[model samples]
Target: MGIVLHLKKKEMACVEYSFHVPSLEELVVVLQKGLKGNFADVQVSVVDCPDLTKEPFTFPVKGICGKTRIAEVGGVPYLLPLVNKEKVYDLNKIAKEIKLPGAFILGAGAGPFQTLGFNAEFMPVIQIGSEHKPAMNGSYFAHINPADGGCLLEKYSEKYHDFGCALLANLFASEGQPGKVIEVKAKRRTGKLNFVTCMRQTLEKHYGDKPVGMGGTFVIEKGKAKTHIMPAEFSSCPLNSDEEVNKWLHFYEMRAPLVCLPVFVSKDPGFDLRLEHTHCFSHHGEGGHYHQDTTPDTVEYLGYFLPAEFLYRIDQPKETHLFGRD
Candidate 1:
């Protein structure tokens, strides 16, 4: 519903003579002018964190797609329902109701902490903890009481390198075949300092087979220099081959701001790219309308720019940095 476009310093300067138009088609047209004639490689990166859960679906009781306020624990609101006298919980059935084939679900804890993915469009779900615990407010997932687990989910995210592995398992259950998996590991020698290494060989396997593009996310732990990379990886073909690996991390640099903008492939194609500056969480209105009746303002864009090295490291810096300067 929203998108932010940021052009790195070098890329912005390369297109000094061109202009940015509001529509996606316009952007393509402007870009084509510079894209011609032995031009260096230009890559575009996009990260999508949708406000899949709307109003009424906030809590798990009504349905998996709406919002609700559950009972509180330790003076904090945890999005979990108390085991009623009948001891009935309809969350799983609710998930079945909204499941869509080939749907990708992403979740986080202590903040959008727990996420489940199935190749289907179903109620956005987040499950937390064993039982009988307090919940803490989470940013990316549902809010939980801190007393419930003392931010254990955040710790898991840090440790496993893939925060919501359980959710990924849930998502994989839909296909019956595991999709591409990449794991990054770190050793905490100095207070959450991260030294990351890719554990999945398939991560770099897809390089030139598919048309290269960019999508993924990057977050620096509150104050740590160590950065966690969430690359936007997808495939028209189910397998993760060597053809398109680089596309996922393609144009990571340029550190452009994520802003809401219209993306048009041609005069006839367009869609809204949501951008969040502060946090990657937002709730949508009844009918795909963003920023409606949600508290803490739904972020349209996550931030500006992918890491500069992500872009420069790929191939061409001038081509990717086009509109806004970093």
Candidate 2:
């Protein structure tokens, strides 16, 4: 005998889901998974407690060349058209034009005409010749290409120069200001790990919903590492075909003790801002744009980062064909 009962239908209701804050171990696991099984023993810890603002002042520009716009950040003038096509730039002159009593600036871009010999001390330059080659400070001028490599030139007189090239960089200038400090360390392991990706994920999880910008130096404590260099200088438009451009991308594997300058953003600011950008210049006379560690049982990374209260995005292209996307 079967018993039948009247049943009432229920309506489904939407529920908001809150993401749980991940612990350090949990965050490490997530980062390991993101590395696709390439694991590196990771450790993350806050070093200093600084009174840092939750929100940072953002200054964004769409294009640099062809426009006569000069913006000042912290009383430092940032002229966009100074590094346009067919334009000559003197690093000493630029420093004089933008120098403040006490300030610091950090950005990346292309510069120094490859064909013309310029007296400048810059390294890890990637330019296209018969083949893609990674050029360093002492030997950069030897490799002559119509276009130069993307580089970070500071406003210091120790390394100054004039160049006929174009650039797009965010110059952060400010007096002494405190920023939140964090330190990350990874021990030698058998597999590779993407340092930038790991740092980005960790920062995002740490900061939660708030966007943050960080700049600091990192060192490849030991073992072999890998980095890439842009084979051709960047412009508002492409100078080579997609196929050729792809061929021009070059990577280098080098020994340890490579010091790097990392400029990272925790969240996209709705502008054409790179979430993570790092460039390395080593005292061993080898450096370039950092990629990942590729050493087996001998790879280590030790880095300290400080979150900034301001981020200036300069010279964004109106329509960029970068990476073959419009």
Candidate 3:
């Protein structure tokens, strides 16, 4: 008798877009439209948006994302989905006796895949060094301090090496400080190296923040906090071609201290990854398997390099997630 192999498709993570209705009367219309579009289990809730002018953060609305301050309006519901906010997961849970006022929000979350795809096509610009720390555009809620309501994203500074909260100052309007810093424990999966899974695992340590998508140029997980010497020749270095770029990077590998490699991703699953270290190139998936000799900086198979125009901050990847806010 032949053996029947019953195969089950893997339940890969999925993301989708959310919608906004102007009034309670529009809820049914939106829900009917969504169901027609094949979306299931439509849910609704109330949320209040902060007045950026009044609430204090260099960027106030950014302090709240994902985890909504769910509110109810006259027995109706709404939601403020800030998919753009940087989140560490945990948002303060308002007391049961408390209630929120109705706020305006047009749309909800989109598959980070869709979101990042949009970013790659339209907005691929990123900054080097802490000058504006453009990589950190997410809301400050990810770095909120539980003890004192401190937010770290508002205070990262390259000058004092304050890295947001290098001064260990208050993040929120409270008086308490971070109770203590504790390192999160990590365990690697056996066999194949899964970069996305690994990154997601580390981020899971934080209560509220989770990755929706990655595109263009980004750092998944900061490898080290220490900065290595950037070659003086780097200023004049041209990353014009793979060959030229490889030589410049080779100069660092043999002498310079270890630096963080900025990773790039594409929508295509095949050539979806790139690691531009000592001559990096695109890989099939997750930069392929981590070979015994494979180093963090090398993303390509042939060891080619990317030109300088594509290079991100070569100084050091942003290791500190949240810093003390002013």
Candidate 2 lands at a TM-score of 0.56
**All candidates: TM-score:** 0.19, 0.56, 0.21
Tens digit of per-residue lDDT, candidate 1, span 64-105 = 111111110010011111101211122232223223222222
- Provide the global lDDT of candidate 2 against the true structure: 0.42
RMSD of 1: 22.3
Candidate 3 per-residue lDDT, tens place, 1-326, comes to 11122223631111111111123233223323332222122232222323222211122122122212111111000001111222111111111111111111111111112222211000101111222222222221112233653212221122122111110100111110121111111122232333332332222222122111211111213121211111212224333344443343211111111111222211112111122111111111011111122233422111001111111111111222211100
For candidate 1, the TM-score is: 0.19
lDDT of 3: 0.18
On lDDT, the leading prediction is 2
Model 1 per-residue lDDT at 217? 26
Span of ten consecutive residues with least summed lDDT in model 2? 62-71
1 versus 2: better TM-score goes to: 2
RMSD of each: 22.3, 16.9, 22.5
RMSD of 3: 22.5
Q: Give, for candidate 1, the lowest lDDT window spanning 10 residues.
A: 307-316
lDDT of 1 at 215: 18
